[model samples]
Every structure is written in C-alpha cells, then in structure tokens.
Target chain A: MTKQRAGLYTALTLLAVLFLIPMIWGVSSAFKARSDIFEYPPRLFPAEPTLENFRAILDGQPFWSWLLVSTLVALVSTAVAVFLCCLAGFGFAKYQFRFKNALFDVLISSLAVPFAVIIVPLFILLAVTGTLNVWFALIVPWVAPAFGIFMMRQYVEQSVPDELLHAARIDGAGEFRIFLSVVLPLLRPAVGALAVWNFLNSYNSFLWPLIVVSDPDQYTLPLGLQALFGAEGRQYDLVLAGSVLAAIPSLIVFFVLRKQLLDGLTAGAVK
Target chain B: MSTVSAQPSWWRRNEVRLAPYLFIGPFYVLYALFMIIPIGAGVYLSFTDWAGLGAPQWIGLENYRYLLQDNSFWTSLGNTVFYMSFTMLVVLPASLLLASALNARGLKLRDTFRIIFFVPVVISPIVVALVFGLIFDGQFGLMNALLQAVFGFGGIEWTTDPLWARVVVVVLVLWRWTGYLTIFFLAGLQNVPRELYEAAALDGAGAVRSFLSVTLPALRPVTAFIGVTVLVSTAQIFEEPFLLTQGGPGESTLSIAMFIYRAAFQRQELGYAAAAGVLMFAAVFTIGRIALRLFQVGRNA
Candidate 1:
C-alpha cells in the first residue's frame, strides 16, 4: 500500500479500538468488586474474577421473569410486525386498488410522527382497551411498521414478477395461497431483515414499556437492568452483570443478521 | 387445464378489488388504532386536564399554556437541543470520515473494523448507560483513573456536576450513534462510481480535492437522512439521562422525552404531558424540515 493509504488504515484501527474499549472494559469490570471497580489505575482484567454479581442479579431480583418477558415480547412482536407488513406490502405491490395510495400515504406520514408525541395518548388508549399491563400493549403497536411495509413493497414489486403470479392464478390457486407459497418465499431476505430489526427495536424499547406497565414482574430486560441500576446504583459489578447478560441476544442477532439488516436499512429508507 | 371454473362475474370483479383491501386492511386498521386515533385523542386530551383516574375536565389550551410557562419543560428542551447539536455535529462528519477511510482503495481488515463500530448501534442504551456509568465513576472511574495516572489530575465529579453530567450524556450519545451513522455513510460511499474518482485523478485533482468535488456531493443525501434521524431520536432521548442521572444534578441531563415521561407517569399530569408531546411533535417536525431544506441548499450549492 502507498504511504497515505497505510496511514488511513492505522487511523481506522485506532477508532475501532476506541469503539470496542467500553464493552471490553465492561467485561473486565463486571467481575470486579464495587471497591475494585474504582481502582486508581484501571486494570484490563479483574484481579479476582467472581460470579457473585451474576448470582445476585439472577437470583436476587425477578431477573428470569424479565428475560422471559423480553424474549416473548421481542419475538411475538417482530413476528406480528413482519407478517402484517408482508401482507400489506404484497397487496400494495401486487394489486392497485382504490384509496391505496391515500391509505399508504397516511401510514407513511404517521411514521414521521415522533413516538414521544404519541406515548401519552397511546398509553391511555391501551388502558382503555384493557391491554395496558398485558403483552398486547407490546405486540399491537409494532405489528404495523410503515418502513417494513415500504421495504416489503419494494422487495415484492421488484422481485415477485407478473408471470409468476399469473402462472399461479392460471393454476386456480387462491390469492392467499399464491402469496403464501410464492410471494413469501421470495421475500425471505426482507423477512429476515424486518425480523432482526423489529426484534432489536422491541427489545430495546424502554419509554413505552416503562409508562404502560406498572407491574414489576412483567418488566423487560432493559427495565430489569434499570431496576438493578436504580436499586444498586453504586454496585457496578452487579449492574454490569445484568447489562452483559441483557446485551448477549442482541449482539448475537446483530452479528448473524448484520448484512440483511444493514442492506434493508439502505433500501426504501428515504425520508 | 380445466381448473378455471366459472365464478359469477360480479364476484370475480369484487374479489379482484377486495383482495387487495383484505390483504392491506389490517395494517391500516392497526395504524388507525395505534397512530391516527391516538394522535387525534392526544390532541383532544391536550385541551383537557385529566389524570389516569378521573374523567377529563375540558379546558381550552390551558395545558399548553402551563407547559409554556413550565421551567422544567424549558430546561429539558434546552438540554435536548444542546445534546442534539453537539452529537449530530460531531458524529456526522466523523462517521463520514470513517466511512471514507473504510471505503478507501486497498483497505484491509475493514470488515472487522466495521463490526467493532456497528456493535454499539445494536446494544441497548440502558446497557450503554451501565457500561458508561461505571466509566464515569467519580472516584475510581476509568476516565478519572486515566486522568490521574496520565496527567496527575484529581477525580472529576462527572455525574454530580451539572455541566459534566451533560458532557457525559453527550459523550454517551456520540459513542453509541457515531458507528451507526458510519454504516449509512459507508452504504452511500459504496454507491459512488469508481470512474468518477479515476476521471478526477487524471485531471490533476489530489485525493482531498477529488473527495470534496466528487465524494462529498455524492453522499449529501445520506448526510441529510442521518441528520434528520439524529434530530428525531435525540429529541426523544430518555434512557441515557434516566439511567445515568435519573435527570439529576438538578435535572440538568433531562431530555424533553424524559420530562414528558416523568410528568405523565410520576406526576399524573397526563394532559400537560400530552400537550408537551404535541409541542415536541411540532418542534421535531418543523426543525427537521428546516434542516432538510438547509441540507438541500448545501447539496445544490
């Protein structure tokens, strides 16, 4: 490589390390005692690694319930959202109907509206529907993502050809079956992308869950971790243990679906 | 081959039309129940004073009037603006540079670097809060330890000091978002044709000049997209401050979203919070539009 290109690579290496430092130090500090975390010279590794912090978080609090709630909510919500977006995307892409543009336009506009603006009213709405403290509050709102619909439409329209649908129809296959057997199979990548995206989003969501659910036992992992932080503010090891545990699923999902997720982000992500 | 059984003409026609509606209907229904109705309900509720328990007493814009005069509302708004401006300014350019570096010809081990950077985007803010909360430890934090060891500096009260509390939050936002934005820029960078760079290279244009004349203009739209996202997300920021300080150090780190949440949930000021939410929607909408326009103008220039 040329001199300038070599310099650029070195700089990029430094930035990458700078980015990774927190997680590395987090793992290092997670096993350290509260006092040791405040060591005058920060050590790269814990002096005496212990599982006590993890034990306390897992055993002491309603941590298992939180993890279960988080897992259930993320998966169910993502599935619902992806399936709904697929139906809408297929309809919008395959058929041209009355008020289609207007309806889709409204959904798209709602996407631009800030979630913070709707939180207060949505909380009340969920309460009125008697779904406030239940899993419905988590699953329902996520089931209709405008971005997912848009992406699916783009994917279906571009990839699902006219001849294929026509051929399916000529075989006397029902519209739903044609979509089920043919269209959906073609939309696998977008499905994966939306699944991963929605899962991460639903998993990380804090404000809505924090406001809607008052029950402690139903708290998600994030809320659980926050509760840990709140209860044990100075207990860095314990809090970090909860955090490290909470981070694993998302990290793994991201590593696996990074390509699909990132490509989906760039596709049909116009403002 | 005889599978094309005769159906009634009207039924067939209706099916053709209604099938699309049937497929897409649930989405519209959900959007209405979740988004449109709640938005309308929020606007209506903004005009009344109600806790979750009581019937809403109808008043005319009083909640908004109170929000306008609310000192905490103003403080939260100010802090959000401060955080948004600082992080967006720093992250956008830095991400662009990093994207450019990764996009550079003959770059090796770039995939590893990309993953390292992008990991933060997927990690929850609460986890980010946990990790950084330890780092910002007042006595023996990695930050302070480094300060003491390298420069013989004493510990700084990062979370407790109001100014430093804001600083910590800004740094956290920067760390979490910069890599996320970098990927967008990288995607943008990949779209630029190599021939443009080659053509410029032959015209006696240096790398720096070629980048400004070629790469910068090409990535303008991605920059705008990132900018608007930053504006919208930062305006709604809650977890960072809520986790790090619980809007403490005299509420210096409180974002507008945090303020709205505390109002609605903690204080039972539902109407006030809804009105504040309306204001936030308007603020984000208007500012985002103006910023997009500015970006447009910059691109055209």
Candidate 2:
C-alpha cells in the first residue's frame, strides 16, 4: 500500500510539473533579454533578466487601453449574462408554464449552432443596423448565453427549494422581488462560476473581435498582441511581455474563485 | 382602500401565470435576434454572392458546387474530423485517467494539482499559441533542445512537417482541455455512492471490476455532457493551428473554421465562406442532436 501510494504521488507530481512548464517557461522568457530568449541549452530561469520588454510594450503601445477595453467588455458582459441567465434559469427551474419544455429545448439546441455559421451575417447585421459600436456589438448580443442559463438552471434546481418560492409568494412578495431578494442570493456560488467563465470567454475571444474591431485604436488585448506578433517582423519580445501581463488578471480571478468555479461547473454535469 | 382590495388587482392575480414568461423573455428575445435571425441570414447569404458591398447577387447552388470540388475545403473538413477524433479518443480518456487518479481517497494536495492542471485553460488561447509556438519551433526550440539531451534525436520538425504540425495542435488541445474535463469526471466520481463499491468488494469484485460496474455507470451523465460539449467545440477549432502553423506546410492542419475565416476575411469569398459555414452547422447540429438523443441528456430534468 505504501509503495502504491508513493507511486501515485510521484506520478501526480510529474504530471503537475509537465502542466506547469509552459507557463513557467513563458513567464521566464518574458523577463529575458531579447538576445537571450533563444539561448542554447535553454535555461528554465532567466540569467540576465530585465524589465525592458514590459517597459517597452507599455510605453510604446496602448497596452492599458487594450486591457481596459477587454476588462470592461468582460465585466459588463458577465454581469448582464449572469442576471439574464439566472432569471431565465429560475423561470425554467421553478415554473411549469405552457411550452416550457419546448422553449427549453429550443434554447438548448441553439448551443449546437456553431459561431462560424453566424459570423458573416451577424457582422453584416450589426453593420447594416449601424450599431457596430464595440460596447454594443460585444456585450449586447452575447449577454444571454445558453450555457450560463443551463448551468444556472441546474444550480437552481439543486439548491433552491420550491417550498421557499411558495412561502415567498404567500408573503405577498412580487415575483421579481422574490427573485431579487431570495433567489439571487441563493445563486451566489453558481454566479461566481458563471461570471468567471463568461469573463474568460469574452476576454480571450479572438475571432469575433478580430473580425469586428478593425480600428487599431480600439483593439482588445488579443488583437493588439496579434498585431504586434504579425507586424513587419514578429515582435516576440513585446508579445511575450504583453502575454504575461494579459494573463495576470485571469489567473488572479481564477485563483480567487477556484473552488466555486470548479464545483459550480460540475454541479450540472454530476447529476 | 376599495381600489387596493378590488380582486387584489389584475396584476397580482395574473402575475403567477405571466411572471415566468417575463423572466425568460429577455433571453428568448436576444436568442431570436442574434441566433435565429443570423442563422436565417447565413442561409440566405450562402445562396448569394456578396463581397461586403451592395446587394448580394443570387447565385443558386454555385458556391456549394464549387465547395464540392474545392480541395482546401475538403482538406479543412478532413483535418477538423481528425482533431475531433483526437479529442474524443485521446483527450477524453486521458482526462478520465487523471480524474480517477485525483479521486483517490486521501490523496494529498489534490486541489493544488487540479488548479495547476487547469491553469492552461485559464490563460488566453493566443498566449497559449505563442508560448507553444516558441517551445515547439523546429530550430532552437526548448522541446527540441530537451529531446536532443534526453534521446539524442532532436530534428523533429514540429512546425514545418505536416504530420508533426497536426500532432502539435492535438497536443495543445490535450494540454489545454484535459484538466477542464478532469474536474467534471472528478465531480462525477465523488458523487458515486461509496456503498456501491463496498458491495462490489463484498461480492469479490476487484478494483477493475468495481470500476467497470460501478464507476463507469455512475459517470454516464457527465461523460455524455462532456462528450457532446467537446464534440461541438472541437468541430469548430481554430486558434491553435491558425496561430501556430497558419495551416501551413501545405494546408495540412487547416481547420474548417480557419478555412472559413480565410475565405471570408482574407480572400473576400464571403459567399463561399458562408456556404462552408452552413455545411459545418448542419453537420455539427445533426451530430449534436444525435448524441443528445443517444445519451438521453436532460431526460431526468
């Protein structure tokens, strides 16, 4: 038994190291001078590390602007998406109105519709309507994601009791008031999970933003990094620095909410 | 007082029946506008030729016919299928193994391992691609350097060779997604009744037998959910190949999504791109529906 346990830990430790190498290497490379990035017998830690890459990218490019736009888009979209999803999920979970199953089926089936299918027409639709503003285009269309609704529905069903809703209704509480005061508080963990998920999605989104946001001045982090990488020669130093910085917020958010995110994500699937 | 007491007002009386509709209304409204209408427009655009300018010229079946003969379209479709199969076969099973290991009773620092494994997914795909591109570069890459030191064989052509390029993409997919899927499986494993395993042990069933009979059956729902999710998402893979190889060394790793992006944005073949998109939608939607039925997902709900 001891031998088996030892084997397990060894294997787990090895796998963990394998998982961490790329990020560690990338972070290390970000600090390395441009000349030492591809040094022979590639060292895991930078020898003569400097702040030049980070300083150069920050000073020369609109790094913070890209970060701001990405953060704002992710934050706003997450907030709106969480509210709409929770409301819809509550409706689906607690109610048995007409066409409920059919409505749910429609919503769930929409998940299968590839984004590639909508890329062309959605772009044109936004263009034709003259509502192609970055904020509107990014946030409004995606604020009611089906996955969020599904996750919220599963959580509501599991955690919130039908009797509680009846009690609230009996106490002369309006439906919206009940949801706001009662249901919303109950959905805190799932909300954290969904918010992080939505934020990462919006923040990391590349293709949609790449197609829609043409103006360089309005580029998101991914677009700005892509531009830097694809410029005259690959701006590896700037991009690596930008990549490291771009990853910090997401990593911090994930670490802070790691428990809720993991548990909340699996709540729907486990049953 | 009379007005306040009059049948408790019409709004109060009907709120129960109408509240659900109101609650779910916003989602359906946005869904129809963004999802249904755009799909309708995509279908319409598929039948016409447009270049982001004036009214589209109706060219019935021409794009589809052209796509039928387009080698790049076929190659992209083939590569996408390869990617999808790899995820199902390689990544899914690997995750299950990882989850099983993580689920072991009294395992130390399980949470730490889980978090570390999941870090790749939290990072942006572009960052992932750049890091991977540097590590796997054919010349002077960390991977090659390590290979040379370990096995004395280093010239693997990670990016330049067609087969190696596809392998690199799959490796990236595995690294990025295995942990994400593992958490779901771990959750499923945790939920499995401990009594079932005890009963299996009492029946003289060994670890493998108990796992087959108890754990596998218990994990069906999660596996189904993950299966369908992975299928649909992998069907539309883009970033890895696009960023790493640019579908190069002769379009060997070009995904259908990349093909569409190139055709529509780079080549200005919007109609052709839409046609390709329609085909992908049909395939994915059909497969997803079939998988949903096969798994009986959401049936209990």
Candidate 3:
C-alpha cells in the first residue's frame, strides 16, 4: 500500500480499537475478583480470572427467572409486532380505503408523543384494566409500534409489486391468502430484520416494564440487574457480571441478523 | 357478465370490503386505546389535581404557575439542553467523518469496523453508563489511570464536580449513540451517486471540496430525521443519567423525565408531573417541526 493509504487504514483501525475498548473492559472487569475490579492502573484483563461473581448471582438470586421473563417478553413482542406491522403495512401499501391517509397520519403523529406524557395515564389505564403484573400488559402496547408499521410499508412498496397482487386477486385468491402466500414470502428478509430489531428493543426496555411489573418474578433482565445494583451489598462485580450476561443474547441476535437489519433499513428508508 | 352483474362490486363485497379495514384495524384500535386515550387523559390530568385516586379537583393552570417558580425544574431543563446540544454537535460530525472513512475506496475491514462501532447502539444505555461510571472514577478509573500514567496529570473528580459530571453524561450519550448516527449517515452516504463526486472532481475540486459541494447536500433529509428523533427521545432519556449519577451530587444531571418519574411515584404529584410532561411535549414537538422546516429550506437554497 502507498504511504497515504497505509496511514488512513491505521487511523481507522485506531478509532475502531477505541470503540471496542469499553466492551472489552466491561467484559474483563466482570470476571475479575471483587478486590481486583478496582485496582489502580485498571487492567484490561483480570490477574486471576474467576467466575465467583457469576456463580453468586446464579446461585442465590432469581437471575434465571428474570432471564426467562425477558426472553419471553422479547420473543412474544417481536412476533406479534412483526405480524401486525406486515398487515398494516400491506394494507396501506395496496388497499384504497376510506380515511386511510388521515388515519395513517394520526398514527404517524402519535409517534411523536413523548413517553413521559403517556406513561402516567397509561399507568392508570393499565391499573384499571388489571394489566399490571401481567404478560398481556408487558407485550401489548409494543406489538404494533408505528415506526415498525412505517418500516414495513416502506419495505412493501420497495419489494412487493402491485401487478402481482392484482394477478393474485384475478386468480380468485382472497386478500389474506394472497398476502400470506405471495407478499409475505417476498417480505421474509424484511420481516427477519424487523423481528431482530424489535427483539433487542423489547429486551432493553426498562421504563415501561419497571412501571408495569411490580412482581419480582416478572422483572425483566434490565430491571432485575438494576435491582442487583440497588441491593445494600452494592455488588458492582455481580452487576457487571449480570450486565455482560444480559448483553450475550442480544449480541447473538445482532450477529445473526446484522446484514439483514442494515439492508432492511437501507432498502427503503435511505438508499 | 351476468355473474358480474349478480355479484356486488369488488369494493362492496363482504370479504373484499372488510379485508383492508380488518388488516389495519388491529393497529389503530390498539394505538387509540393505548396511546391516544392515555395522551388525552394526560392532557386532562395536567389541568387538575389528581394524586392517582379519587375525583380530580379542577384547578386550571395551577401546576403551570407553580412550575414557573420551580428552580429545580428549570435547572433540569437547562442541564438537558446542554447535554443534548453537546452530543448532537460532537456525535453528528464524528458520524459524518466515520461514515465517509468507512465508505472510502480500498478501505479494508470496513464491515468489521462498522460492527464494532454499532455494538454501542445495541448495548443497553444503562450498561454503557455503568461502565463509563467506573471509567471516570476519581481514584482508579481507566481514564484517570491512563491520564496519570501517560501525562503525569492528577485525576479529576468526574462524578462530583458538576461540570465534570455533565461531561461524563455527554460522553456516555455519545458512546451510546454515535454509532447509531453513523449507521444512519452510512445509509445516507450510500444513496449519494458516485457520478456526482466524479463530476465535481473533473471540475478541479479536491476531495474535501467535492464532499462539501456534493455530499453534505444529499444528507439533509437524513440529518433532519436524526434531529427530530434525538429531540423526541432526549425528553425520555431516563436510564443513563438515572444510573450514572442518580441526577448527581447536586442535581446537576437531573432531566425532566427523572423529575417527572420522581414526582409521580415518589411524591404522588401525578397532576404536576403530567403538567410538566404536557408542557415539554408541546415545546419539543414545535421545536422539532421547526427544525425539519429549516432543514428543508436549507436544502432548497
């Protein structure tokens, strides 16, 4: 490589390393012994790595239960959200209905409503519906987020051809049948991307679940991990361990779907 | 033809007539119930004195009046504005440059760098704050240790000093979002035709000159979207600062969201909290709309 090209690559590599250090440090500290965690000239790797913190969290705390709750919530929310988005998106993309634009406008505008503005009244509504501490409450509000619907509409417009739908209709295929068999199959990549995105969003959600689920058994991993930090012992080691563990599932989801996710967002929105 | 006359028009048929509405109804129904109704009730609650129970006593504009004199509320809003602007300024430019670098010709391992940077976006903000909290610790933080080891400088109190605390929060916010903005710009960068750059190059424009004349103009819409999104979400950024400093040693980092949460839950001032939320919502919405309009005008110019 020429000198200029070599210098550019080196600069880029250094910046990338800067980005990677926090994650590396977080993971390294998670394994260090409680005393070693705060040592001077903070080491990148533990002097003598140990799993005692992880063991303590798993043995005594309800870590597994929280993980289960978080996983269930993430999976259920993603499945329902993607399905609902596809239906709404396809409807908007293909169908000429009364007040379609007006209704869609309202939905789009509501996306701007600040979360704090809604949280109080939503809390009241949830209490009235006896939805607090229930999975139904945990999963319902996020199931058809307006952004997801908008994303799906963009995807449908880009990939799903109008002529195909017309031909399906002429073939005596019902709308639902055409959608399920023809349009949906074509949208598989987009759906996969949205599913992964929604899963991570749901998994990282803290404020809504923090308010809705009062039961210790219902705590999501983020909330549960925060509780570990709040406990009187103030176990930074345990909290760090829990944080890294919580991130593992998301990283796995991210690695598997990164390309699809980026391509999905790019296909319609920007590019 | 006889069958067609006997059959109702496609739009009038039962299944065909209802399919579109059915497909779209679930989303609107849930949205109205969960989002619209709650927002309406919040607006109403802002006008009354309700503490999560009993009949709400109507007291028009009283909460707003009290809020006018409330120093804490003002301070939190001030802190948020500062934090938001800091990250927006730093992160946006950094994202633009990084996206450009990643898009440069003959750049190897671009995808790996993209993934590395994007990790921060996926990681929980709370976790990011916690990690950085340790990094900024006065005594044994990685940052402090590095400074002393390399420059022989004394460690500064990152969490206690109000200025340093705000800086820490800004750094954390940038770490959590710079990659996100990078992805947005990356997508925007891809949409720009290479021919534009080539045309400008042929006109005796250097790389920087062409980038300015060609690249930045194409990214206006993307920047507008990012701006409004940041505005809306900045109002709700509770987790990061709440974890990092719990609003700090002197309430230096307290955001309006934290204030509202504490008001409703801790102080049972639901009406007051709702009022604050409604006010902030209106302000942010107007500002966001104006920002988008300005971006459009800039593009047209």
Candidate 4:
C-alpha cells in the first residue's frame, strides 16, 4: 500500500509540473529580451530579464484600452448573467407549471447548437440592423446562457428546500421578493461559480470578438494580442508580455474563488 | 371558513402560477432572438447566394451541391471527427485516471494539485495557443531544444508537416481540456459510496476488479455529461488550429468552425458557408440528441 501510494504521488506531482510548464515558460519568456527569447539551450529563466517588452507593448499598443473593454464586458456580462440564471434557476427549481419540461428541453437542447451555425447569419443580422456595437454584440446576446441556467437549476434543486419557499409564501412574501431576499443569499456559492465562469468566458472570448469587432479601438485583449502577434512578424516578446499581464486578473479571480468554482461546477455533472 | 369567504384579488390568485414564467421569460426571449432566430436566418440564407450586398439571390440547392464537392469541407469534417474521437478515447480515459489518483484516500495537497491543473483552462486560449506555438515551433522551439538535449535527435517538423500539425492541435486540445474534465470525474468519484469499495474488497476482489465493478458503473452519468459536452465543443473547435497552425501545411488541421469562418469571412462565400454551417448543426444536434437519449440525461427531471 505504501509503495502504491508513493507511485501515485510521484505520478501526480510530475503531471502537475507538466500542466504548469507552459504558463511558467510564458511568464519567464515575457521577461526575456527579444534576442534571448529563442536562445539556444532555452534556459527556464532569462539570464538578462528586462521589462522592455512590457514597456514596449504598453507604450505602443492600446493595451490599457483593451484591458478596459475586456474587463467591462466581462463584469457586466457576469452580473447580468448571474442574476438571470439565478432567477430562472429558482423558478425551475421551485415551481411546477404547464410546458415546464418542454421549455427546459428547448433550453437544454440549444446547448448542442454550435456557434458556427449562427456566426454567419448573426453577423449579417447585426450588420444589417446596425446594432453591432461592442457592448451589445458581446454582452447582451450571451448574458442568458443555457449552461448557466442548467448549472443553477441543478444547484438550486440540490441545495434549496421546498419548505423555505412555502414558509416565505405564507409570510405574504411575493415570488420575486422571496427570490431576492431568501433564495439569492443561499445561492452565493453557485453565483460565485457562475460569475467566474462567465467572466473568464467573456474576457477570454476570441473568435466571436474577432468576427464582430472590426474597429482597432474596440478590440478586446485577445484580439489585441492576436493582432500584435501577427503584425510583429509572429514575434513573441510583446505578445508574451501582453498575455502575462492579461492573465493576472483571471488567475486572481480563479485563485480566490477556487473552492466555490470547482465544487459548484461539478455539482451539476456529478449528481 | 371566514378567511375563505374573503375573496382574493386576481393578482394574488395568479401570482404563484405566473411568477415562474416571468422569472424565466428573459432567457426564453434572448434564446428565441439570438439562437432560434439566427438559426432560422441561417437556414434561409443557406438557400440563397449573398455577399453582404444589396440582396441575396435565390439559388436553391446550389450551395449544398457545391458543399458536396468541396474538398476542404470534407477534410475539415474528417479532422473534426478525428479530434472528437481523440478527446473521447484519449482525453477521457486519461482524465479518469487523474481523477482516480486525486480521489485517493487522505491524499496530500489534493486541492493544490487540482487548482494547478485547472489554471491552464482559466487563462485565455490565445495565450495558451501563443505559448504553445512558441514551444512547438519547428525551429528554435523549446520542445525541440529539450528533445535535442535529452534524446540526441530533434529534427521533427511540428507545424510544417501535415501529420505533425494535426498532432500538435490534438496535443493542445489534450493539455487544455484534460484538467477541466478531471474535476467532473473527481466529483463523480467522490460521490461513489465508499461502502461499495469496502464490500468489494471484503468479497476478495482486487483493486482492478473493484474499480471495474464499482467505479465504472457509478461514473456513467458523469462520463455521459462530459462526453456530450466534449463532443459538441470539439465539433466546433477553431482556436487551436486557427492560431497554432492556421489550419495549414495544407488544411490538415482545419476544423468545421474554422472552415466556415474561412469560407464566409475570408472568401466571402456566405451562402456556401451557411450551407456548411447548417450541415454541421444538423450533424451535431442529431448526435447530441441521440447521446442524451442513450444516456437518459434529464429523464428524472
């Protein structure tokens, strides 16, 4: 048993290191001078590390603007998405109504619809309507994701009790009032999970943003980095530095809410 | 009796019944407008030729007929299927193994391991792709340098070679997704009653025996959920191939989504792209529905 356990630990530790190598390498290379980035022997840490890449990208590119756009979009989307998902989740969890199952099937089945199917027509639709603004295109359409509602429903079903709703109702609490005052507080952990999920998704979203946002000034972090990567002859220095800076917020968010996010994400799948 | 005699207002009477719809109304509205309507438009647009011009010309079945003869479309579809199969076959089992190890009794720093594994996924895919692109570049890449240092041979072309390009894409997919999938499996493993394992052990069953008998069956729902999720997502894969290889060395790694993007955006073949999109949607939706039914997902709900 001791030998087997040791083997497991050894394997897991090796795998953990393997998982972290790319990010670690990216961060290390971000600090390297352009000439030393592809140096023979490829040292894990740069010998003459400098902040030149960071300064260059920050000075030349609209780095801060991209950060601002990504942050605002992610935050707004997360907030609205969390609220809508929670409300819908609470409704599905608590109430039984006509066509309930059918409605849920419709929502759930939509998950299978690939984004590629809509990319062409949706772009045309937005373009024709002249409502292809960054904020509207990025956030409004995606705020009510079916996956979030499903996750929230699973969580609400598992965590929230029926008696609480009955008790709240008996106190003359309105449906929305009960959801706001009672249910929302209990849904904090799940909300954290969904918020982190939504934030990461919106902030990191590349393809849709690439398709929709044509203006350079309206670029998100991913698009900005991609353009810089391409424009600079596939150079890694500036883009690496940009990516490292871009990753900080997402890493911080994940680290802080690791427990809730991990547990809440699996809550739906496991059960 | 006196309380019953006092008539309740219509608002009071119908509030409970109506509140649920009102709560869920916004989601359905957005779903209809964004998803249902766009899909409807896509279906309509697939039957006509358009170039973002004045009007779409009616050209029934021409786009579909062209799609039937499009080699790139066929190649992209094949590559997508290959990726989907790789995830189901390679990534799924590997994650299950990782989850089993993580679920080991009294494991040390399990949460630390879990968090570290999951960090890759939290970061943007562009960053992931960029980092990977540098590491796997055919020349001056860290991977080649390390190979030459350790193994004494490092001449393999990673991006330029068609086969190696596809391999790199799958490797990227594996690295990015395995940890994310492990969390689900770990959660499922945790929920499997410990008593079952104990009982199997008491019955003289070995570790492998108990795992096959107890663990596998218990993990079915999670496996199904992960399977369907991976299937749908991988079918629409774009970024890895798009960023890493640009679907190149001759479209060896182009995915359906990338194919659609290339056709519509780059080539301005909106009608043809819409046709391809419709076919992909039909294939994915049908398979997804079939998988859902096979697994009996949401049957209880």
In order of listing, the candidates' clash counts read 0, 0, 0, 0
Tens digit per residue, CA lDDT, model 4, A205-245: 99999999999999999999999998949778999999999
Q: Write the per-residue lDDT of candidate 3 for residues A15-42, one digit (tens) a residue.
A: 8888888899999999999999999878
* Tens digit of per-residue lDDT, candidate 4, span B244-271: 9999989999999999999999989898
The count of backbone overlaps in candidate 3 is 0
Q: Which regions of candidate 3 deviate over 4 angstroms? A: B1-18, B291-301
DockQ of 1: 0.57
Candidate 1: regions farther than 4 A off: B1-5, B8-11, B287-301
Model 1 whole-model lDDT (C-alpha atoms): 0.82
State fnat for each of the candidate structures: 0.66, 0.75, 0.52, 0.84
Root-mean-square deviation of Cα positions for candidate 3 versus the true structure, in angstroms: 2.5
Which pairs, if any, clash in model 2? none
Model 1: which docking level applies? medium
- Give me the chain B TM-score of candidate 4: 0.97
Q: Is candidate 1 or candidate 4 better by DockQ?
A: 4
Which tens-of-lDDT digit does each residue in B180-238 have in candidate 3?
77877888888899999899989989988998899988887777767667777876678
lDDT of 1 at B127: 86
Worst 10-residue lDDT window, candidate 2 chain B: B1-10
List residue ranges in candidate 4 displaced over 4 A.
Answer: B1-7
Which DockQ values do the candidates obtain, in the order shown? 0.57, 0.83, 0.57, 0.87
